[model samples]
Target: MYIATYIIDIAALIYLMGLLYSNAALNTSRKKPFLIAIILTIVIILSEAGTVLTNNGSLNLRGINIVCNVLGFILTPMIPIAITLIFSRMILTTHKLLLISTFINIVATALSPIFGFIFYVDANNQYIRGDYFFVFIIVYIINLLILVIITLEVGKTNNYPIIGKLVGLSIFTIIGTSIQIVYPFTYSSWHCVTLSLLLYFF
Candidate 1:
């Protein structure tokens, strides 16, 4: 199942990248955020693959695992946030806020190895819950809620064609994050995001 999901995710990211690359016809308003999502998706795939590939039982490989895990933890939440911003009324002007949010996670992840506050890899190279595990869910949930609210607000004009699909993204992200929070071993969050993007474009 892991291998299948990994392959699906990488394939989805590659397809999305290609779709967006030559998409000169993408809605001009949403095109920038869409491109940003593609870039972040690539970052996420690399980080996810790194975590999967480097988890041998050796202490030397632990560094790679830790680094990859930290990168994953940081990139994981950004996916939904980026997707939400793409569907919402957000633009480049509001990116500083996203940067601040990402910076907070980056700091917590950087501190996790020492303090185990954000996330930590066990001696077995497994993800051990940290003090701030719920923090990821909270951030994701808040972003999802904000995305939903914006979708509804845009719906007020009766011109928001993608409201339902955006809401689906919200629901999928919420469920995926919830499952991942309860069962850290499942790797559900990234998969959910990939599925959501597929729905968004298709």
Candidate 2:
């Protein structure tokens, strides 16, 4: 089931790399962050898949599962941060507020194994959400909100033609993410993100 989706993600990653290598404009500083976002998306996809596999693998695999889950939680929100940077015309320092959620999420996720603040795997090798599972959800939402605001602002200020496309993409992402949040086993969000990245490229 997930194998097909992940295969598509790999195909898109390769396709995007081919496009980026051939297109000089996409390799410029202004557009480079999108490439970074693509790379991050690939990492998240792999981590998510690992989490799923390790969830039922073996007791000895618990450590690997925890690592994959932590990586996914920490990096998932950062994709939006990367997208936000791609649309920014100011210095990187100006995006401090935009990064707060990601920083908080990283801390919470890192401490989860000991504190179980974000998530934990059970004695049965089953993955379980901790008291602060919402922390990861909120962080993802906040990062996406910041991305949308910056995208709109950039379009408005520069009269760029990105507002409609980005707005539509944001809606698409939100719906897909919301579905995954509601139905944890669905595995739709990352695939939506991969499609969004490919769409944005075109």
Candidate No. with top lDDT: 2
**Error of model 2, residue 42, in angstroms:** 0.9
Q: Taking the tens digit of each residue's C-alpha lDDT, what string does model 1 give over 1-202?
A: 6767777887887888788767877776566676677667767767767777776567768888888788777776676656666656553365446446556777888889888987788787766768886666566566566666666766666777777766777787678767866776677777777777767776
Please, what are the lDDT tens digits per residue for candidate 2 over residues 71-130?
988888888778777778352676676677778999999999888888988777788899
Please give the lDDT score at residue 7 for candidate 1.
Answer: 79
Worst 10 residues of 2 by lDDT: 89-98
Error of 2 at 85 (Å): 1.6
lDDT of each: 0.71, 0.84
Candidate topping TM-score: 2
